[model samples]
Target chain A: MAEKKVYEKTLGVMPDVISGFCPGCMHGTVHKLVGEVVQELGMLDKLVRVEGVGCCGLGQQFVSHDVIIAAHGRACAVATGVKRCSPESLVYTYQGDGDLASIGLDETVSAANRGENFTVIFINNGIYGMTGGQMAPTTLIGMKATTAPFGRKVEEHGYPMHVCELLSQLKTPQFLVRTAVDTPQNVIKTRKYIKQAFQNQIDGKGFSLVEVVTSCPTNWGYTAKEALTFLREKMFEEFPLGVYRDKDKEEA
Target chain B: MAERVFMKGCEAIAEAGVRAGCRFFAGYPITPQNEIPEYFARRMPEVGGVFVQGESEVASVNMLYGAAATGTPAMSSSSSCGISLYSEGVSYCASARLPVVYVNVQRGGPGIGAIQPAQQDYLQATKASGNGGFRMIVLAPATVQECVDMVYEAFELAQRDNNPVLVLTDGVIGTMMEPVVLPPMKTDEDIKAMKAKFADKACTGHEPCKQHFCFPGSVGTGQEIANKEAEKMYATWDKDVRVEKYLTDDAEIIFAAYGISARISRAVVKQLRAEGIKAGMIRPITVSPFPYEAFSSLDFNQVKGILDVEMSIPAQMRWDIDHAVQGRCPINECRRSGGQLLTNDQVLEGARQLIKEVL
Candidate 1:
């Protein structure tokens, strides 16, 4: 028998195109995971992707769905609009830490609190990757960023935000999970968490958020390998990987 | 058949929105315009529409952007400070060419000015609504009826132009009560059909569609191309320029105004005409596609001078009047600001003074 093809690129993705993200940025991986999940769930035709600022905004170019780019940090609000207006469509916002936790904190919290029936795929890479490695809301203490030259200090800059933890406290969000994409196992687990978030939306279970701990090698001033190690060793310490809230599992 | 009901200006505008098939509303509470959202909160659900009292003006406008991107008739309203916060989202809407409707119930301002009715935001509404020099189709309504009517028509104009439209009223019109014949409510099927018609081009997740919706950087050549397209769209809006001319054919002096100021100016014209003064009024219903043509058509040789009446000190509409008159006639301004209403007598006195200057 002829060899059978097992794995192929997702039909929800544009083929063989270079995104505007920096080299080795995990935004591409997250985008791929999202595209694959959408394709697997037979939601390719029903996916409305709302893009935010920073490198994650480039997901609009790579995703083969209807994508609307929002103003900086306004993706969650925009996604809320899309989902509410077209309830049959699966709408998701792809945002960076700066876009979600910084300028968009109010929108993020408000959407979660409203229990908006949509999915949020938050990429937390500890630094602002698009504007040349500036400090982000998720940036770890002692992390070196352009905006934090002296390295982040708890007294000066405050501690890095734990978005999953913060959002999980809200009663409205149906699912809230924190996952990383640094290793093979972690990447698979991250994909699973993201799929579950999308599935929650499909099931009409109001807001679900998957926070992906990502590596920004170019922004972090490290090689791809070093960045992966840093994500596992340092970043994971501040943002531990686990499901913070699962309404279905909790009820069961 | 539509029923006549005495409704507040803000409530009427909200009713008009629902009647026009506006299925999505997201707004923040602001003085003078709070009734808009409050009305929508009760009425939208009744019509099977979505209503979200957003976290802030910023969030509400962006939410409108999201809903409008799906080609849903979405609207938002705010007062001056709140409108300022919506600027960024408005620009995004323009960049994306989404037909969104917004209302700014004008109030005294340069900052957190008084909440009293004022026309201080004329320049902001007409000239620079948002960054990148995008112009919205700004409608100035002088009456509660016009407010309801304009808010009803604004959705069509917005959809026709594929841009955001602003219904600019003052706190007076927003809070005042009047009998208005509301338009018939849009049936659910009509709204669905409209959505289906736009689903192909809209970012509503329908398949066999364009991959990208409307992001400046994501599109070809970034915002430069999108902006160029927007400029082209703006050039075609000359056909939409609207103005109401009263007794200007044989008049020697013309009073230029809009919104509440225009309402006051109309009364002033009637009073001046009764007093045997050759006074006429030119009211711009669409302030952005301003009545420049109206000024140009006037027999400048026969005209004595143009008096610009406004509720803002130092005048904001005067610039458009000056541009329209183009030195053909001397222009004088009669204005009040800081939430002070311009009385008809004040306008009458100012017009008499301008007539004296030209005579």
Candidate 2:
């Protein structure tokens, strides 16, 4: 038999690079987690990940899970359709804080309340990373983005919204957790929680949410390393970390 | 076979959709159209379908999108305010070329106008209800029977063209209870055939049941894909636009109207014909294609004038009328907005005045 050299570069994974998100954005981290989960669960063939507008909008770039980009803040609703239409496939959404927590709060809360069998991966960077770092609902106290350059004060801006805590209180959500990737320890924890959230949906448990506390180094005016420190020191204090609700436990 | 039963227009639409093989109904309750979801809530389960009262119109339309993408007949109904909320999903459906039947029972609106019948949504339904170069096959159902008939035809057209179809009715038509005879419900085999043909082109990959020499890709090359789709869509739409002409054969003046406005025009037509004033009606059944040939083919030299009757200020239907006539016929408009219906007497008065001014 003739010897043939197997190509090493061409293998199972995302493209070498893509134009979906800007550099130093946490969308890449979230996308990686989502793609990894789809692969691990052997659901890449039976998955449809709906994307929304913002930094993480064009999920088609990295999400090899038969991705479709919906209108702004409509990922959850679109995923609802995908999951309902094909209950066999595992449906998920990769959304940003502005996409889910701000403009799409109704869909998020309602889908959770309906206990829709799907997974939601929410990234809270506390700013609109796509539209030039505008102030977002998840923006931490005293944080200054483009819209809140004077510093987000409680009197004028209201308190930073903790979506995980708020959604955990709702009666329908089966799994809700808040984790961060500010450090190596939290990064590992975020991955574990994200995998579990996807697993719950695959098991037809119900609506599962994994809110990852992430960072935008360019938007936050910090080095990539320094951005991680800020997320751990400041963002962690306000948002906290750990599971807020798990219906699977209640059932047990 | 003509049978009779007293049912609300909205209820007729729901029942007709059920008969048309729709197994998924998702919608939010809005005034003048709440009966649709309520009916579905009661009857959808009996047919072994899923009925979801979506949290909002946005979610409802999205749910429709999801269900329809699965190759099943899925439908959603809402009024003008709620339909506006569904624009995002409409655009998504349009871009994806998914077949979904959307029922828009319109009320007055530039912004939350009122819960009353109006033709204010003519432009939104026909022109650009959503984004992209998209045109929905708008079906204007003037009578309660039409509300029943159009719902079935809308899904049929939706599946045929693999595009969304809107049943554009008004608050009166949606809320009014009248006699209607619905056709026999579609069989599972019929629905299965449609589901196989109209499901998303990319979803389940390619076909396994080709009789002839099989070729890769059902739609062919990516470069020629959109043009081919456009050509197929226009060809299909050519046969889909339907209109009805009453007393137009020997009329000096013709009234172009649709939906509840068309119902008012009918009474005016009857009174004008009795008075020998020769007023007729050309009711557009499909508002998106707009039945341009029906108006353009008429002998404009013999026809003196056209009055576009609607219930919205500034006459939205006048645009389509003028486009059809192409400056050959004189056009006038009679309309009222802000949740008010244009009464029969008002239309008669306008038709009489137009006769005096033009003839």
Candidate 3:
């Protein structure tokens, strides 16, 4: 009997380099999904990934692709430049909650509004991971962070940003979805969303974004197992997973 | 030779950039330089290029960064306050070695002081364009014709150094209309070949998707070494120093000026020469890698004094002149600030006063 192959290495990520993400962090998982999408699409040679400043910038270290590390909060604008110049090359920006929802909000909205032919993978972790857990724009009202030691207040910090909901209001973006990677079942769903975002760009369908509601175990102060549990119980309650917009399926 | 056509400096600059194979431009609306983006919007599509009126000056420069990284000649144009916004992205471009070009049609400012015209951004242009001790080759053009030529050459200089270059004109030069013989527009093939040269390091997807990249914003030996390498590269820019040394061979008083101020200074030189005072002018076309050698080489014994004529209060270019003159001759300035244009008679009187003090 011939041995069956169940798993194989993907060259989308560099071989043998350990990721520096803290344990229980979803950056590695999301990165793995992106790497899988890159390989599955046969775009390992022509993918230009623009990584925003923050934990997402670590994509430069292990992503085996043409990479541009954009200045803090400027990845969307940078990706716009790359996509406009090399229309044939696949381009995307990887950004975190703070990088996308706060400092980079204008770039995020403008790129999506223009319907730029590219992809955006937004990791909404509710806290600034690389900066050691400052409250992010997407942080829940009662969530505690280094900056909000006593937990966020409704009057002081305001409400969390629902990126999928906010961007869905735009008429241009071809695809917009919210997903998670906290459970094996959700992880499979997350991969599908990521793949669809890539396929949107490949089909020249214009801007597509997948907002992943992830957890930063180090910053959230939880063990890997407990973090997944917390993400399932707490994070899911705030940012429920679903497709926010799909231009292809919408009435033309 | 191309036919000479009368055009505004800003329009000439836009056309020159397109002709030089600059395929991408992203800029925001700013006073005294609005025509630049307006022209690009109408022209880029015709030339098979792109134009983006970005969300802000900050986003526009970052867009230039992304476009430039792919080996495409990219540019952005702005005025005083807008260039301040461009500083961060400009610094990033320098560190990343992404060749990019920008134009600053300066208007007066400590804080949007006035919109007409002023040379107050001289120090800002040459000394501290941005953080991280990064430097750019700043070009100052006095006329619409020269503006066209400098803009044409700026892309090549940027590509050669793999660094950012600035065309420092003024509201006077940017808005004023003059006859310019434009360079031939670059063909589609020429632009493609230019980008192909940067294919190796450019972020364009080449199969295998290989890249080793890092941003320098930390305290480490790697950044230190990169800074040192930048310093060595800046040192070689001395060869690219451009200054218009006019009749300094037998002059008693020399006028040091640039841009519109330099244009005025030339008339002052002739007016003084008519009166037999033997005045000459040294104009810096390339303000950064400033032609200090032009000043240091002057026979100080024969030269009575050097007058700094400018449109700023403290004479911003004085810093470079001080370094060049090195106390050999007294450096006094005839300057008008806050959008005030210097008159030829006013500068001639200042030159006479300087000559009296030195003699």
Candidate 4:
């Protein structure tokens, strides 16, 4: 009973229910962060979330806020529309690696370039979680998946897209930070940055992104605990974590 | 009162959107309909509005969905291939029942099939372009002037029904220049009057409205509220189907067409009248609520033959006409596809052939 009570407080506004995500999924952790931020900011009434296809696609379903499910690879564009149309509504998008990096690259870069006033929570879990472990754009070089059984060869398949570095080139996008939630200490920092991104929108600042370096235990062929160690050791080396852009401080 | 001016069909559509009190325009440029964005790029700013050249058609319609979600009269324009990219947003708008206007300047399809005009997207525009059992009110205009005129009706019907409305014009109607009269522009005072009465529809939290009167929690779980909303959409579509009839009182054959093809059919009707043969044309302005009753009102006993003028090889609209007639008259289809438009001469020749075979 005490353990249940402790977990209850952490969820904030996330309803307690069985979700489509696999057990011990990092999506649950990210959703909790999103819900806590919404509750803390008092934006539950005005929140308009656009969810895309993936494991995190179901993030909106767990939260107690107004939500709109966008077509795959189109969440950012939809959120851009929503924000421009209702400048007052707090708009955000929850997308996965495949939806953001591969199919919706144009929408992502352009929205960032134009400085669309919205928040984007990108879940980068190496493999495509929803469609069975396919080769994602972020699939580490020489990593095996269903599509790339031998491994993602750098010479043949090209290098993984450094979306953070690509987005950092854009002059706009007020806040862009990449963080991981594998550790409890890192999870707290991830929550802080995610909240700050939404707060930037509330402050009428431009586009903000919180790219979460998450885990795919089921697809990555590892136990949930081992996946956390994999992210810390293998993934962080390839995609480093930290703030890529902070325009507010840059101007100062 | 209607004012007349020589204008390209695409320009007329942009101008009509303005007259209809559309304050938001988001679109990406595509062939055969690029003029629409250019027109709005200049005109929207002049009218104290926002015009975004979206990164892509997907972005544009999502932008449209955003604007429409706020109850603003918003629209996007695209040619055939670009319109295909907008299908996802269209489906969401349908599910949400968000009122928006989409202008598809029809071009050849299957994948960027030339920039020339064609009526290949008839089925796509009329059927549910989105998910579930959702439908869009498709308005097919026959002329540049009607492109402007029908857009106004499209906006009106969409808002009144709280559903998405499509203005289906071919590349011919979009590119061809013709004389048109712009509707009277709404003044600041007019907007103020509308705002005073209907401001709640635009944004929430107006004077702390009751929870029951707010945004719906999900899609289709509510009872009386959802039913009442759906009933309003259905009733509005039923009443807004517009059709034009020509010389149908004592005609032996009737021609069915819409958009650019309808214009050609009208010319064929005139030629048949001159040749001492009784022929008429029935033009459907609203393709979705399809004026079945309007076409059925024609005396089929006297109508010995029917011809469908189309720009598709498979005879799309002719199917609708056949359903309307219910095997009452001998029907034939005359069509040209892959970016080819039927000429007045070609349509008349088809009519003449049909008349000889039947009469």
Model 1's CAPRI class is medium
lDDT of 1 by residue, A28-132 (tens): 888889989988899888898988898888776667888888999999899989899889999999899999999999999999999999999999999988789
Q: Let me know the DockQ for model 4.
A: 0.28
For the candidates in turn, chain A alone yields TM-scores of: 0.97, 0.90, 0.97, 0.94
lDDT of 2 at A66: 57
TM per candidate comes to: 0.96, 0.90, 0.97, 0.88
All candidates in order of lDDT, best leading? 3, 1, 4, 2
Error of 4 at B278 (Å): 1.1
Per-residue lDDT of candidate 4, residues B1-359 (tens digit): 66889999999899888878887899998989999889999998788767889988888887787666655678889988898888878877765677788899999976879889999999888875755556778989888878888888787777766678899999988998989888888765664453343444544222111111213225455635665666566766676777888887888989889888888898888888998899988888889888898666667778898999999989898878878888888898889999987988888888888988999
lDDT tens per residue, model 3, B243-345 = 9999888998999999999989999898888988888999998999899999999998899889999999978999999998999988999999888888888
Candidate 4 residue B319 C-alpha distance from true site, Å: 1.3
For candidate 3, lDDT tens digit of each residue in A1-252? 999999876787878888988888888888889888878998867788898988998777788878888989999999999899889888989999999889999999999999999999999989998888999999988889999999999899899989999998898999999998877998899899889899999999999999998888888888888888878888889998898998877866
Model 3, stretches more than 4 Å misplaced? B212-219
Native-to-model Cα distance after best TM-score fit, residue A109 in candidate 2, in Å: 1.0
TM-score of each candidate's B chain against the true B chain: 0.96, 0.91, 0.97, 0.91
Please state the error at residue A208 of candidate 3 in Å.
0.7
Q: What is the DockQ of each candidate?
A: 0.72, 0.24, 0.68, 0.28
Output the lDDT of residue B152, model 1. 85
Candidate 2 lDDT for residue B310: 86
RMSD of 4: 4.1
Give the candidate number with the greatest DockQ: 1
- Candidate 2 runs further than 4 Å off: A1-24, A182-184, A250-252, B1-4, B198-232
Segments of candidate 4 deviating more than 4 angstroms: A1-21, A38-45, A149-151, A202-204, B1-4, B128-133, B186-236, B294-298
Of the two candidates 1 and 4, the one with more favorable DockQ, higher being better, is 1
Q: Fraction of native contacts in model 2? A: 0.27
Evaluate chain B of model 2: give its TM-score.
0.91
> For model 4, what fraction of the real interface contacts is kept?
0.30
